[model samples]
Target: MGTDVQVLYFGILREMYVQAREEHFSLASGATVADLVERIGERHPPFVPIRERIRIAVNEEFAASGHVLSSGDTVALIPPIAGGSDRYCVVTDEPLRIDPLVDAVAGPGQGAVVAFVGTVRDENEGHEVTELRYEAYSAMALRALNSVIDRCEQSARGARVAVSHRIGELQVGDAAVVLAASAPHRAEAFAAARMCIELLKQEVPIWKRETSPDGAEWLGMRP
Candidate 1:
């Protein structure tokens, strides 16, 4: 069978493409991952970022930039992650129920519940932030979040968790996110909650935009 070529896009690049994935473009007999990126970027300059930091995969396994791509290969553009807040009562595009997460973690044996809520601050770095905006590739974002939650569930000692995040234009002090975890012991809850937030920030596909005194700009993940 002939090889098929696919183009994957993510992050701000998606905003430019206005779609999650692209299905056009095929290898001419033979093509490498780098060749595909060059063709795409030549056709779509915004794909430059994808060329810079994207991870290439054949099928599902990670490949190098120079890897040869076969037909029917599924390529994914993975973006750097920004941490989600450490707070319970988290909100995303829609509202979330905190009580359920609380119930999931509570136990007669567990003693303490630790929760964190992240609010959009009016100020960032030095300027006054008028509002904040959050955007995501919803399907991927939710999947990544669920993955983090599942991992935490295995490690937390009877921990229950709740998270909520806000999307669209959000004013300062508005709730951007919430996380809560309960464990048999306070220490475990605290640790679990912290880990959850850290993992989310590092893995989730959510990005933030900040409107400040000067203007608006997208926020990047801290190294």
Candidate 2:
């Protein structure tokens, strides 16, 4: 007997394989995630290079390599999602630029532009943070980011908003996020900017990994 599964890909993997990244596979009964990965590699030799780093998810939940696959399961091969992005509601690996975002939102009628930049600090929770790694479920994260922009613009009258977030390993002093909110007045701009960021944190599916001198751990929240 064979167990069938839906395999999905994200980030770099998705870009590399394009439409072929998602496929329906029939595997031997009781196959493990590792076996699925190997099977994919056999189909696409390029997948072999990053096989070890790809995180597998079963039905939207992160699954271990040894997790047994069941028929009808949805498996996602997640490459570092913050590892890539689509600009505008940007989740990119490129350095964050606030000027572009500021100019983007600023308009002829808008008199105030509230710009916010989030940088990686050298310490967190009394720990000396050496670096930070960011990840996201790219497709969903983009939608979540756009949702925040929509909410801010609607709630704050005359507000125009733009946001950019970076992923991948970043050092201290690097900009993790940059945003601008423009409005006819300072209050509206400020309110929209604040609301956008708060909503992004609450709703987006981005993750952060903090590395200290001793150890490192990942969080479901943005850093």
Candidate 3:
């Protein structure tokens, strides 16, 4: 018998798959995440365009392409998010707060806390940027953020991680993202913090638009 997995779509995927945000998909028993994605791509032509950009999460945690799924599992096709929350992964329109995120990752046993803040810059590629706007596929972004945190935590044993990204209009010098990592040693904390931000930029589905004197341009892959 086939397994009935609950599949969820967010961001562009939600817009493309308008029938429903959540659907029951039938897959062979012991199906891998890649198998389900392949099925979806075949069923929905639009999914084929972003097949590589999309990330998968099973039951709210990031799942690998090879991760196995079972009946009743909830699989989410994450797009990316904004804003801040106490949770390890947050996306919001509100301005990012750094102190709380740093404190959140700090613990009694942790001797080092590393924090990284990414702010809107005045220029990019020689273009004089006036302001920046950020957007995300919230549900997917949150999942991706959590995935980055999970990786950082795993790479830096005993480390705790917290991260936040801000959406909407942001001026130069405004904080766009903040990441914090705490561990028993400075090395681990530093490594975790670096990994968290790098993975976030590379993996998360957050998009940025730059408004310059010339014009406005959206950055990253088009959906």
Candidate 4:
């Protein structure tokens, strides 16, 4: 395989990806597996974790650390899977709503209103989860979330929008997610909320950790 392949270190890999993805790396034309990883570490110290728990894959197949890397070969770094939440947790702590936190956006003349509530599920991918811990890079996460809300409001000028998510450990039934938008009509409100949620998921620097009967695992990069 070629040495210049796309690398994916998802799951528990973010801790390392965050550091390594930041720096530029160069490899000799026919570097070996050890060479690439060494270069990665030289560029970003966090990748040192790879020496122990990280897994290597070449072109979608598992490979030993000594595997040779050729030009055009896809190299992937797979970190252990940290647990994920049972469901999307959406919430707003101040008020109680029968319909979920997103119901906060309401207007009499508005023809359309839309909201999304993410609940905590009891299980994730078959694991019995006891609770979830959310960690946020407050400044970045909030900025991203507010930006999403702003976009929702801009697209539907008359819309009222709200977004609230929980941080810290949360038990089942706790609200972990909330998105609400009200517009001149339902379609715009719904569309705006959907877009906002998608953007938040993609851009926000929030991470979730899950504690299950078996053990505790991180869901994403700790922000």
TM-score of each: 0.55, 0.61, 0.61, 0.51
lDDT of 4 at 39: 72
**How well is each residue in 1-223 modelled by candidate 3, as lDDT tens digits?**
8888998765435765534567788999899999998898887876776677665768766678999998999887755323222345557665667776776787889999988899999999788999999988876787788778877888977888988788889999999998889999999999998888889889998899999998898986436
The local distance difference test score of model 1 is 0.65
Q: What's the candidate order when arranged by decreasing lDDT?
A: 2, 3, 1, 4
Clashing pairs in 2: none
Q: lDDT values of the candidates?
A: 0.65, 0.80, 0.79, 0.62
What is the overall TM-score of model 3 with all chains considered together? 0.61
lDDT accuracy of residue 62 in candidate 3: 62
Weakest 10 consecutive residues of candidate 1 by summed lDDT: 82-91
Put down candidate 1 lDDT per residue, 1-223, tens digits, no spaces: 4457775554334544435445567666567778877877777776665456555545545567778777778775543333322222222443333444464456687798776777888788887999888887765765576667767766865766655555677887776777777778888888888988999888887789998878888888436
Task: Mark the 10 consecutive residues where model 3 has the least summed lDDT.
Answer: 79-88
- All-Cα superposition RMSD per candidate: 13.0, 14.6, 11.4, 17.9
1-223: candidate 2 lDDT, tens digit per residue: 8999998765456766534647888999999999999899898887787687666768755578899999999886755333222124557675767876776687799999999999999988788999999988867776688778877889878888878788899999999999999999999999999998899888898889999998888854437
> Which whole-number lDDT from 0 to 100 does residue 77 have in model 3?
72
Regions of candidate 1 where Cα sits further than 4 Å from its true position:
1-91, 94-100, 221-223
Error of 1 at 17 (Å): 24
lDDT for 58 (candidate 1): 57
Error of 1 at 147 (Å): 1.3
Question: What lDDT score goes with residue 164 in model 4?
Answer: 65
